[model samples]
Target: MTDMPLGAPGQRSVLRSLWQTQRVWLASATILAALAVFDPLQAAESAVFAVGALLNTAPFLILSIAIAAWAGATGADNLIAKAFSGTPLLMIGLGALAGGISPFCSCGVIPLIAALLAMGVPLSAVMAFWLASPIMDPSMFVLTAGVLDLEFAVAKTLAAIGLGLFGGTVVHLMMKGGAFADPLREGVGNGGCGGAKMRAPRPVVWRFWADADRRAKFGKTALSTTLFLAKWLMLAFVLESLMLAWIPAETITEMLGGDGLVPIATATLVGVPAYLNGYAALPLVGGLIEQGMAPGAGLAFLVAGGVTSIPAAMAVWALAKREVFAVYIGLSLSGAFASGLLFQLWTSMT
Candidate 1:
């Protein structure tokens, strides 16, 4: 028999390396097996929590990933790259508008923004999207509506959009006449480039839902995707569940009992670092309001916590230059304060 080709041997070696390195599969399998051995009631409760967490992030994760992959494949990032061709002032306006429409949260936007920056999108526009997208999106508006009064929702939404716009504008102004800071450092490969060479058209999120692939084979795709995305999602759930179980709703209310700048600032400061998802954030905000926190302050905290995420910021730092990353941090902090202050004033005046 002819000796095996070098290329085939090399491919197998690479595959083996990947299999050994990526522990996500192993961890997932272990957790699942452990769950299976638990008492019936405990197993059921864990299962329910797992399912809920899976469902909560699945919609956004799948859609965002699909959009990102498609955008990468089609060179749509170059379209983003085009934003840099314009004056900083113009790009800032464009960034503000894009931020207003994209409903993906701070974390969800990372992959998208990274892709845009990697493709050469203007720093001003990329930063704009980073600052604004979470605030003005439809889902946020829906949450605001359901969690607070309609007037409060409208005011919150406007303040969020304004923060994004203003932050972008300020950064652009500050960086004006400066050299462009390169965002993408290393050469990161585009979606699907690592595994296969197929040029098939990118499918919609729903299509990925129905189609068979490495993931969908035997319904394992759903399982793998859930496992891949579950780590951070778990943080949100565990914290929220604990807060629900141990922290009296009354305690939250008592702490925030005042409609003033101090209360709003305090809430915003506390929230910016917490990294709570909507489920957790809503209850906390509602509890504070029930305790007498100004509606605007509660709104501000929610907006800040949801939008200004440290984890996401770290990713931005890894992907972009120090200067741009610094700008991002400053803008996020300023925007959070602005949103908090505006909401506080509006609440006090009304």
Candidate 2:
């Protein structure tokens, strides 16, 4: 019944819209170029960093689009909402499952979540899934496994699942009968193609064939999403390159040495202000591990870095209220710390 428009209002076509968003790309590129002024080597270094990141992150972004398309086409959107209305256990399970699949970094997930809400997802469930997905993704696990040990991977998965379920249950109970449904009813409405009407669910075989056809027809769109995420990852690489060129790994290690809670806490605190994509933070974290930080702690830092950005907080505040935003922040922080602490304990015990 909502009158949300089909596309962003105006005369712009899809290509034009893509062009419009290039402002962010330009700004990021400009920032990289400016860093080159510090030294001539920096410019080539920046370009190489950007290109390398784009190559590395391409698979992750493709995976993200595939998941997103599945979610959209399957209409799991409503099911996710209904799960929130059901038992806390159901919601928790849903959170854990989504955490394992979604490829969105916390930053990317924010906008998608806002859309999900408009489509009728439950607030608590959406929040829970948002918190968990960045930390618990299979991609993250694979990446972690490559840098860290198998034990570290196991511990991180358990922590992510536990925090996701625990946090979802607690937040749901505390905010019982709260107004998470309000935002979707008012102001800027949900997701792209928001106003597009939904079609009846197609049969399984039909959907299988249809998806194949659509992917063929819309390959460019899928690639756009991939390219978009890659572009952001490239920016992150540029930042990492700068850090590597100018900053000393020893300085960071000296500031917060290995085998303690201080490094974890410092990493979390540092993450609160800095906004890096989840996959993007990997290179930096890998660097940290090379510099003598524990793998578990580096994982904790990467998880925290993506989830607790100011932009994420502000998005919550803008859509919901200050109180709701506070709860979101508080729960996310607790989730981050809990995951970190649990992994540390698990590591020591096993």
Candidate 3:
């Protein structure tokens, strides 16, 4: 039989599927092409800047994805469950701490939360973990340090824990008031990732590599995560380049430069509707900082974006009642504002 041509139906279907999954890459490429057409010199400079940013953060990105893959393959969620299976108060505290270190994005956390709720984990514990997980992670910390500074990264990590604690306490108090008695909306179990089920805990060493299925799982998870992050990082760097090339420094400074409460509040508000991933936000924030955006405002923006971004909120809404969803939003917004203000004060004093 003759060899089929590359343009056969099978190949066409495969290409279509690839494009659907990686539309961000296609979109970014289209935008870059347009930029090149409009201004070739600026487009070349922007491409260089974007590539440099990607190179600078590649190590941390790889490390984070590897860790996340290992955790997924080795059943890290079960470990989280065991750690939080103590007293309600202890669960809350430990859950908050776990949230800080867990390698999950906001949307990625929804499945875990659904699993925990289905398993009868305390709402307080779930609340703590849910509130904090999106804001920081081991990989996110390193990425933040690479893009911004160690101080900002450390402060953001601390803020994630603080916000989790605050959220836990509030949920606990509300539970006492007979609120959130039945927080899960219908079909929550059907929501989020279908494959997020917790497996039997295994050793975190070489066991994942030992089993063929586990190895495949790890590889698949890591590759998908790397590609996902790369897409966002590319877009973020391009936007950063545009901001640097076009937006006047004085404009950014005038809007978000001050240490005052107004500027901080504005940043927080802006972040709520802005659709920036945690990793992607770093480069944009770095650009803003270089243009004199206040450290406090930048911190606020990160917290707010992580907490209230559309994807995160949509996940919350899908799994919870309107009232519980409102509380989630309220807690996130309040925590973001408070953390930003405190960070500002600390930065000023030092």
Candidate 4:
């Protein structure tokens, strides 16, 4: 037989690398196994619930990823940068609006930021998008509406835009005041830890499949996106099941059910650290609401968690200096509280 090609060694090396990098999945699997051995019924229920949740959200997730990938491939970002080029105030509003609709999480927004900065986009407009992008997206909006209600969904969208505008305006004023001078550190565009600037593929519309490279890229991106989302969602569903099974509704209601600034503030504080992915947070928040958590408090939790969650904060830390990161966090917390209060008042009136 012909000597075995060197491919086996290369394949083995690739397998080893994949195994090493899949620690999260390995840990999750171990925990699930342990749970099954110790409590089969609970484990089974959690598994079923996780699968159901995944299935329910898969369509929205697919749509969001497709749109994002298409935008990235079509050089739409260049157009976006041009739109906000000269008009600072309009940029704030439009940036916030764009961020709310775009299906980018905090981490996902970083590369886009890198691209915009590389192309000489204004920091003020970028700040607005950065502040709002994590809060919600089209897919997230649909998911939220399904879990909560149309009113809640609409309010959350507004909150996202409102927060973005607030951040953008503050940054613009600060820029005028000589703060944020040379905001980008040297080598940001070099694609170090900050993230690589998104490169626009050759323009292609419905004929994306006509290009072999584009087809491969689309497939890879879609798979990666699905896997990334599935991991968090699986964990979330498991946690949600456990909460429903063990935690008393009375506890959730007592803690987060009250109206007023106190509850809103409490929610904000609780949310900042405890928050996970937006899609993951949905079922948990829904459970809280069902347990009589105040709608306003729930909203506060979502907004706060969306903005200041560990992943989102990490992205900010990677991109900005310590001082700018601090302001971002502060603005997020304050905006969450204010939005919560407004929502509470509105709900009470209506």
Candidate 5:
């Protein structure tokens, strides 16, 4: 009936796309299968731990999902779009402040940055947003509180805003002195490479439930957010269980637990390379904390990894000139270390 023989092409394409998205979950399943074959008891234990952990996180997970969905349905990013049109100094500060709270993901930042640049927003303000956006968000705040604590979540939010201010100020001065002449790479603002998370601004409807379209949008956002968070978190919990079973606590303590700044520095460095998915890293760090890793090291690793993580780096590299990328990386590393040091001092004091 169809022109295509065997009908395999379309089916294969769908299957391949699914596999790419599900590979992490597949890996978790594979790990369980292997464990079951070799150590059935341990496999059961891991499964139990993962389920329990997920259950414990369910409240935070629900709240985060709801927040993300609400933002999408109500178009809260309209506020972010409006924040860019002002004096350069004011714009930069506003940009960083907005970025710290914005729900823009790594994928979203690409199009948002490109859009801002194309609209003639100054580089300093854009840089502030770029630097801080990945550091924190509303859903991230809720999840961090659930995984870590309320105090930690608040500290990270402050760190995100502070880093934005710090980076924005430096970049603003540099631009004044004739650095970063032509920051964008060729054809960056022309378009984006898909996976855009921020939609164009629309008027916020406080009662999204009243509108059928908004209700559908909310459901769609919730489902997608849930799946994305679920996969990474599932993989993270599995890895954490294995790390607990296999890796000795003494090793984690020796490497990342200490009074001086060495552990924080080490964490900052290590996070740039060793960090995995943002959601996935949470439980691993929590596991490390349980193993006596210094809280400061944990915070440093999170900030450094969140900012310079592969997705964030690749987006910058693909969109901006090399110098811009350099400054971004430099700021991220330094800011992460400073956040850790301050957090450590605070923890020690209190």
Candidate 6:
């Protein structure tokens, strides 16, 4: 009997990989396709809206990508690695501040985290960086300001740093009581590509074009960042259109609207399962607020979803013990709720 061709299995594996890698794009296309078949007018209107939205945000998107690419080429993250050598309290403070404002992209932060943990960095400082880094970066701030508002962007930035400080402090106290000793998982010391750079960061070379290699690196980062932002935003805008069309305003107002901590609490819980990405979450939050969800609720949702998102949690699991991961999640949830509560009070006073 003739054996089945081995190429068939290889082709199937290739297709599977493509599907996994491109799920976001595929989901966006699928939504459009379904809408086109069921309601042609709605599909056309959504397409227009998504395209228009992207065009409006184009300037901010360009600036955001430039900042990220520039930071990458100039070795800003190397500076980040070097900052981890101070006292726990000092390091925690630095961690929170640097993470919130750092131009380093999210892609590098994971490896950086791995490297720090591997190098025997204190869990408290690492937790501070870990919580804050994913919450807000330069790119996130620009996109939030563009899609939401300056006030919301500013609030989110504060929330990021605040959450970091809170988590770090808690972890520091717990560790003082002898909790979370030797937290790293087995077989995880290397920082991968990004980690290596952080471990022994080269000095910043701002005039990247002066060197051929740096010029190439700059170009690559720019192109990749642009594509990364573009795809997520497109999917987010499209989903926003669908949400606006289908989800009733009254339902949103009733569940996630109004004064009090109830809406904020509700939003924090909802954010965990609903959040697909930081980039995608902004438009949805904007859409939710447009439907009358409170501003504080939006902040809570953004913070909660960002820290507990699947990818973020998985990264923690990859490097730390189960207990440490649990602590991380616990801190994220509590901090998110508190942020929402505080921001709600602020908005009311203002």
Please give, for residues 1-350, the per-residue lDDT of candidate 5 as tens digits. Answer: 85655548888787789787687689889999999999999899889977886776676567656765675577654454455555778888888998899876754555556556544556788888888888898988999999999998998898888899889889989988987657776544423322122335568788989999999988986776567556655666676577557755345445676557888999898787566656777887888888777888899988998898765776677667888899999999999999999999999899
Off by over 4 Å in 4: 1-82, 190-254
TM-score of every candidate relative to the true structure: 0.66, 0.61, 0.61, 0.63, 0.61, 0.61
| Top candidate (TM-score) | 1
C-alpha lDDT score of every prediction, in listed order:
0.59, 0.59, 0.76, 0.73, 0.76, 0.76
lDDT string for model 2 (1-350, tens) is 86546665543476477676675577567886686776667888778877876566455555556655455544554554444556757766787668756665544564455545555555566667766766656777887677665666676676666666776677667657653335332342343223122323343232533566554534543454455455555555666566556655445445544877877777666656443555555666667777777655775675565556533454465455455577767776666666776677766776
lDDT of 4 by residue, 207-308 (tens): 667777767767765565556555655665566566557755345446676656788899898787567568877887888877767789999999998998
Clash count list over all predictions: 2, 0, 0, 0, 0, 0
- Residue runs of model 6 more than 4 Å from their true location after superposition: 1-83, 104-107, 190-255
Location of the lowest summed lDDT over 10 successive residues in candidate 5: 190-199
lDDT of 5 at 229: 54
Position 84, candidate 5: lDDT: 57
Residue 22 shift from truth in candidate 1, angstroms = 6.7
> How many pairs of residues in model 2 come into backbone collision?
0
The worst-scoring run of ten residues by lDDT in candidate 3 lies at 189-198
Show model 3 residue runs off by greater than 4 Å: 1-85, 190-254
Pairs in steric clash, model 2? none
lDDT digits (tens) for residues 7-75 of candidate 6: 788778987998977876887899999999999999998899889877866764666556556666676
lDDT of 3 by residue, 49-139 (tens): 8899778766646665666677667656456556666787888888899999987666456556665664456678888989898899998
